[model samples]
Target: MVEFGALPLFLCVMGLFSESLCFVTLEVEVGDNVTIWCRHELIVSGYIHWFKHTCGSAPLIIGCKQFFGSVPSQNCFFFNESERMVVSVQGENTSLTITAVNVSDTGLYYCSSTDLMRITFHETNYLRVKGSESRRQSESAGF
Candidate 1:
């Protein structure tokens, strides 16, 4: 697993090409868990990839799950069941779950699938993480 240390603020830019591209925006406070859902119509035959691409950083393959392939290999890559980042695929739906989200977790997540020699982009999500000002205030007030 790759770790991205403290980074600067991100500037998210998305270019629309076709109607098939799914774009979603989400907002969650720090320390909260967030789940991104990706739906695809293509029958998954090769590999399903979950990538996190920040503004200034290169795209990182945080999670992956392989389906029907000739070469026998691991089912998934990078994250396991207990990791903070987990990717689950069920039929035509796939989800990426991030637990205890923080400032650095903010970025544009992309879900894609590969079958044969073709790759299809399924969804793109822009996650915005808010600071825990309200949580701190509530703790100070002992609520």
Candidate 2:
């Protein structure tokens, strides 16, 4: 199914990390791993959350797997399942990863520090998923 491409709408929301820069970019196959990045200052500590909001369908909350340590009760899966999501912390850097990419994964993903002191999920990503099998078949058969 195709949906209208709409600009990401920001939910009225930071000094951020004084000198810290946060960025989350994902690259993966249709049914492989999807990684989210959040790199910045080392002297800062903040809770992070990853969310994917489709234009039409309900937004999905990445689960406890990605928590820095423990999952926040209020931030729990109050909306959708977050099991597929996992958190990876390297030193002071924070990032989220998702497995099994799907068409539904196509949408705007947002990342924010639970403290609300930092904001960076401002980018909207439009992912287009095509069947690899279909492509292979077409290639073998030739145009």
Candidate 3:
């Protein structure tokens, strides 16, 4: 038999070990196409959501239920063409592709798996969009 007081502590440690989430960062030049990928080890029966978070503003939901064939939300319509912001999902994996990236696209993006209420797994990716001045500086530095 286990000590009653230690049982709760053990469960908490187990929960921490079970929690699975990760993040990645990407840097891209303006007008370039980039793809952000998220994958999970366990099978997800819930929806996958994408969000964009800026420094001062609240996080905006870019897409929801994308793995279940749902379309992206209107707030995600940053590009003129609808297909420019696309989400593709496969078994245990999902990807968000942005075409012709601009300065406005620079921000933190999050991908999460949720049951439409609570998130199960979450990950954040920081996107840095290189501007013309940065490019010129790099060129001058012979980079």
lDDT (10s digit) by residue, model 2, range 24-105: 3344457877666654332343445556665555666564222333333233444344667666556545566677776556
How far is 142's C-alpha from truth in model 3 (Å)? 22
Q: Would you estimate the TM-scores of all the predictions? A: 0.68, 0.50, 0.62
Which runs of model 1 end up more than 4 angstroms from their true locations?
1-22, 42-44, 69-74, 77-82, 132-143
lDDT, residue 105, model 2: 64
Error of 3 at 85 (Å): 1.3
Best by lDDT: 1
Please give the lDDT score at residue 95 for candidate 3: 75
Candidates in order have lDDT scores of 0.69, 0.48, 0.62
Which model is ahead, 1 or 2, in terms of TM-score?
A: 1
Question: lDDT tens digits, residues 39-127, model 3?
Answer: 63335345666677776676776765424333332322232324666766766777788999887888777666655445544446779
TM for candidate 1 is 0.68
Per-prediction RMSD in angstroms? 9.2, 10.0, 9.6
Best by TM-score: 1
**Candidate 1's residue-wise lDDT over 17-63, tens digit each?**
33233347798999999999987544636778888887667888888
Residue pairs whose backbone atoms clash in candidate 1: none
